[model samples]
Target chain A: MRQNIITRFVLISLAAGLLSACSPVRDIRFRAHYHDANDLLYAAAQESDLPYLKAHLKDGGIVLFSESWDVDMQKEIVTGDGQHFDFNRRFVRDGEMVVSVDSVVIFETNKMPKNNDQSRISSLSVLGGLNTALGIYCLAVPKACFGSCPTFYLDGDQEFHYARAEGFSNAIAPGLEYTDIDALNIYTTTGGTFPLTMKNEAYETHNVRSLKLLAVPREEDQRVYHTQDDKFYLARQRVELTSARSGNDDVTYLLNKDDQTEYFSLADPDNLRSTEEVFLQFDNPGNIQQLGLVAGFRQSLMTTYLLYNAFDHMGNLYGDLLATVSIAEDDAPTIADVLYEQLGGISAYLRNSHKNEWVYQGTWYETGPIAINHQLMLLDAAHPEEEIHIKLEMNRGMWRLDYLHLTEIIEKVVPLEIQAERVYANKKHDEDLLQIMLDGDAYLVSQPGDTYRFEFELPAIHDDYELFLSATGFYMVWGREEWQKEKDLYSLYMMRHHPGRYLKKHAQAYKEYEKVMEEAFWGSRVKHQIISGHDK
Target chain B: MINKQVLLVLLMLLLAVSCSVPRGLPAPEELPYETKGTAFYVKLHDGSVYRGELIAAENDALYVLPAENQHPNMKRQSGVVQIPWDAVDNYRVYYAHGKSLVWFVPVYTIVTFSHGWFAFLTMPFNLIATLTAHFTSQHEHVLRKKDIAPEELGLFARFPQGIPTDVALQDII
Candidate 1:
């Protein structure tokens, strides 16, 4: 018994030592190039000279590598699907990338928020006399649609119209991905070389490419769908399978142009009204039993507030939200529009009348898309000759389309383990807020949330003072009261400061810049005070 | 009972932690009891001294627009001094009562009445608080000055005495 105890104790000690060795933290003094353990490598470097990662380098931890490049954002467009576009920058320095730690590479897009400004006369109700007068004035002055809006076609047959290009039309090149270094997510790569590739092959031939490389299965992509009211609607050539599935159960695939993968996108009417109609047509395969829909949804209150008021000066409040998905078959009577009241909207609005005073705030939901199956064979056992029609419509709400599916096969879906690779580090205050700020160690990890926390050593100055924590995520900080309904983390912000490289140059213009900071802080505080019922 | 005790302890800990983060300035009063204008003095890292009326205070810096008329010795160049908080070695603030009662009484009366009759009931407390702020501010500044070392005094070192007495001091905010 005594011998066995001695052996077990030895084994435990060895295991503990191994665990400590595998930890990412290592003494900076032990850097491969450094010779002396007692010498402080950062002692000679001025605070201004030190980059963020180097200045905040902990005694025994890995530091993130930071670099910056100027990105020309003029009329730039980014593809919606998340994937890494190749940057194609060749590095001369050659070293084996050992354990790809966190990285922060900032890009200076310098792009302003999308302007939501509209002519005041446009806000008048359509029936009001002012609207008619404004229309006459616009017609007399210049063509209302001159270079602003143009007619377009959806397909060869259907006519599509838009007030303006649906959204900003900047396109990112294939192979380039924007990380917005200022809002970088800290990631811990599990012991790997740089640029590791991860592919999730759920089906034998259907492999999905995720933005981040991992050695695990990918999360199901969010599919967006739209619907019209309770009538049977159908359109020809609605879906075409790019790749045929192994088993034939009267099922076909629709491809996603963004991801270049198979999916079933519903036919969108664009206009969300009872009078407007959308139709989809697919060749009838034999013996269809059931139809499935993979639907995706996310909502943000801030975005909803902005998008809802984008067209109107102050038209409608929360009462303006209602949407539905309506489907039908070959003019056979309509199904009641399935209500979708949980979808989110987005917009960019100026906090003040000043055009440049835009502040963006909104929420993105994580409740993934669900698969809903409806019994198709129950309606008519043998209606193969009849073409199927589907319609999607909404009253006044906004949502993205996922996918629509028609299938005879039904199988229980096995939930795959999807590990979230992105997380924002947010630290809470303890008994001593100042001390907590000084420690620079404690932090909480939040995923699918934007709030991030950082701690720095307080300068031992003679006067009591505060410094701004400058970084590049969402620039505007939402007050606690303004976002009370949002259960996610709220970011802590000081006065806004210039970016790292521009700090010195900005200080030269400090006299004028100080006024801007004063106004921003005062504006924030006054707004908070009024909203919190302490108007005085 | 055990769970309740644990929860109570946790709540106390949270309260203690929450109380530590500094709540900036007290809320503005419904009645303007403050009769004086806010005064400010700052010593910069580059050994410059600015003494004048406070223009603005923010997390980034304290701004002081030079007082227009002051003792020749105390007057500074005509421009706002933006002392970045990190560059400030020492600073002081006080209330200067210039022509207090002239505009103070009228503004206070109009604002208080506008708020409602109940606002009148709180006038006494506001008055006491304002008085306390005025009388004790300079003394507090003197105490805080001890933290500044002689080398960090900058232009303030030349003026061993307090602000010059040539100009008549009045606080009219």
Candidate 2:
């Protein structure tokens, strides 16, 4: 079905292109010439240069060509059978008319030019046709259009999937604004001026209050990771998995890299909360005192679909729902909590060889589908000799795991914070906005199509360091016009009041839009270009 | 697969660029006089203007077939108008080059969608290119009384070789 839909879309686009090749209208051309009365009289007097003319007289009558009419050049007079008219160009009578050559004022032609150009018309037709087709596509599937929060990029990467960080995705309202940190995966830099570009490529408006870089110093072969509780850890001696199996299939190769080639599964048809386990085995690095399992992963579109469904149900009342959440107390349970709890997260467990049983380690979870988030799951006092066996149990089809590795923990460390020294808004340096960012009180509101470049001077330390982006902001999703027609306040109520029941009831609807929505969402990713210099 | 898509896009771009050249109007010498009638707007000294096709010029007077009948109900009407040199004020003839800026809207919209999220950057660039094309293209040209001699415009008349004695004006214009 998915293949058929894609094929249909391509065929329609081709038809539109072909239809646009034909010009819709013919070009009209006009050629005009003018002559003064004196010029006409002078030319008329010259025997050798008598002007060929189509002439009209408005001396209160109409003049028609008659065989009997004659013009005597010597007498400079013309006599013809014609009609007379008032000064208003109205015709009065048709009779013998005589007029002197000196009485004429003006003589001109009123010929309409013929259509002569075909190339230009054809070009216009193609442009117009393509535009019409694109407009129809946008109208039909607005949900597929590019939309998200502020996305950050490093110097070299241009692809959307490789974005270094995405800021404040969960902060949908002003009151829900908070800071988010993501590892840049850059373990070493030359320690000079560092430039990071922030772009609002989506329809949402981003209110960025602050942006800074968190630099954590680490030795060679060591990587830094942050836990769910926001504790930074320096780890070394990373070990790749010997074998990884999800059910009966080996997925070791898929989870080998931080690249976007992810391993994902379809959601359980019967139940969304149904669990699946991936068993992992890695060569044990002797008896290490402290250990951490590093996992780079992100949620699948299941979460995004649910969020969009909830928003669609809220529809016109979405603003009110956001307002309620914004005004709620810090400790109060919100809809986000309910949804997260209902679906659950990836839980890590280790096998105790002596007891031959799986012991609980830890679980790490974050919401969003754009950026791949990394977290460390610390094991509790487990020292393995021969091999390390770990099991990751997660809701089926709820997550996409990109990279998984077991690392030996070095120690807990603090990040050295470096604030942006200069800020460029839409390629123009704004000193005032930079000051506001430093103050952390005012926000730099970015509308759609806005881009910001944050320049930070790296710390003076010489050792290699890991870089992470710390951005504080919240974004408001622009309500789509199509969603207004799908207002279901009762469904919104069910989602907020009884999420467990809501999930089961809404599963079928999500299933319908899942494939198309995913295709559209990824295909419509916003592309940005960074100019070499700050001035653009 | 990606290479084929890229090649297709490149081909389309090449086609668009090749056709984007602004077309110029045909020169007066190249104007097709035999196949088409040249229209003229004649303004008399009394401020009345008449539009028609030139029929013939003979013996210091000009004969024309007026485009419209001002008094269709009048009896005993002649189908051609005769004006001596002294009754004229000034006359003008023009040639309209077929070019329109209306296509810019759709072209820009298509470009925006094609660029996807990068439209913000490409939109401004597209606007500049469109405006440049519009301003540089010739739309129309007007030849005034001083621009060309009266005898020259006579070449565009309905019967430039002079009216045939046996033919009626209704059969020609």
Candidate 3:
């Protein structure tokens, strides 16, 4: 019937539209943000011409204890069997002229890309002989190790305001009067917010504690996690903002070491960052505030060239574009005495390297890791059994954790997903086996095969220690190239139900492929140098 | 070996001929031709665009430094660069027979104003050298085989120029 034909046509068209809408023609031009977004790091051997030493932190790594804080990073990473890898050398073409580094990713750190949001900036007056710098804060991925970085207050003596409450309203704190009001702002290499703060501003008749400061989450808002026993449970500790709001009004939370629960935040618009301050505005209010800028005078050719181009002194060219904006403050905590509370620091750098998004795209190498794509990537390499700081600078209050790590029980646990545990232990052609355990039952996830999920609940076991599996090599995830943007709804990132071991055999060629992949990883940088040298 | 009078006459004649020849003039036999427009030289960071005869280059930061000196061999430079996107304006790739007044210095120095750091004491030396080169230098240059136009560059000739360059330049770079 014609009716049936029409119905079929409608369904096909709808499906086509949805698919097309999913992936728009992406236009990634070279902008200032690119200077920082290009975070693919390169640690070439200082003495060797190998280009890079490719190393990765294992699923469960050594327990590292911070002598200063008495905290353990290694212990935090260890789930079942601690694993780590360090590639001594990757490229041999440079005749030992270049050095390479093993990449180590600091897990569950600040990985949120820069985005748009309402920003709150501060103004601090200069005092003679004071060494002060603006902190960089990144709006964090909610519920991660660190919830988000705090945006720092900058230099000057003026009343600052921002939309911290549910809506926008103009506000200024007491005692911050300036003749010039030259909007002073904060800066950083990697921007973010602060963790703890105390402020001093003139108060009204009510008392000294009437002042409040407000900051907005720069990325996505936070999502709270709790334990079954009526306690907070999280993978990492964070500063959380809880609020009750009115029209164009915000409540600031101020911590009283005297009374912990009497916290109140101020939501004022005078604190809002405006063109009068940063001299830029968004076409849309939802865009992430462009508070931090990456200032690089030197960089690698490939990172720049691959993004768009590389200019020569003699090639004869001129033209440019720039975008700048202010960060918004969302959470407002009342400040009883202090006018502004500073959260963190800021900084920037150049990669001088390029990620070959084009070359390895859509190929077998594109999934980051074939069997299981790495939604999470760490950026440190040659990670020793020591606590390395995944430093962040921001301008907001730190993600506060009331009680923590209730869910983090296993000494070693595996990702429930990921098809192949294809690991190639390159340095030592030694025993190739993976360790695993589940519910006090010692079992191997795999020696060589596909990794499958199993539900194991043991009541009698208090703490399960070790289990084993076999892998010719290990697994990997790459950042360069357009690894699929956004995540698959069904993708397995973490163990959803309970934790267990997984094992699978990597094919022989997969090992070769890994070596070749490592070669490709470093080989591209070599080509960058060659093309760079002898510039016409 | 000839008489002194004959030698004097020869010397005067040679002087007259040398004076008659226009000094510091460009070569008429420049081998008139065009260049193939290939890769464009863009300032990093800022993303400024420019096109011209890639006469001489030195590395700096992430960009190539160009010299305005038409005499490619004499072009002395430092390896310094600025991301064009970081800067405010764009310059055109135009030079007549040689370098642009603007392009003569590396963009890095121009952008960062690092030349100011050379100090007032050293400025006189730099100024003197620049002036000396301009007055005493022979500026006309020959095009490289690669710079010749693959397509007819005749159309480029009609456009009003910004900083005229070697024949390889277009109106806007």
- Judged by lDDT against the true structure, how good is candidate 3? 0.19
Residue A242 lDDT in model 3? 31
Tens digits of per-residue lDDT for model 1 on A300-354?
1112222212212212221121111112123321110011222222121212223
CA lDDT of every candidate:
0.24, 0.65, 0.19
Summing lDDT over every window of 10 consecutive residues in candidate 3 chain B, give the lowest-scoring window.
B154-163
| Regions more than 4 Å wrong, model 2 | A1-144, A519-536, B1-12, B15-173
The DockQ-derived docking category for candidate 1 is incorrect
Q: List fnat per candidate, in order.
A: 0.00, 0.04, 0.00
Which tens-of-lDDT digit does each residue in A322-416 have in candidate 2?
88888888777666777778888899999988889999988888777777888898987456677888999988767878779888898999999
Give the candidate order by descending lDDT: 2, 1, 3
What is the interface RMSD, in angstroms, for predicted model 2? 11.9
Q: Mark the 10 consecutive residues where model 1 chain A has the least summed lDDT.
A: A162-171
lDDT of 1 by residue, B133-152 (tens): 22222132221345433332
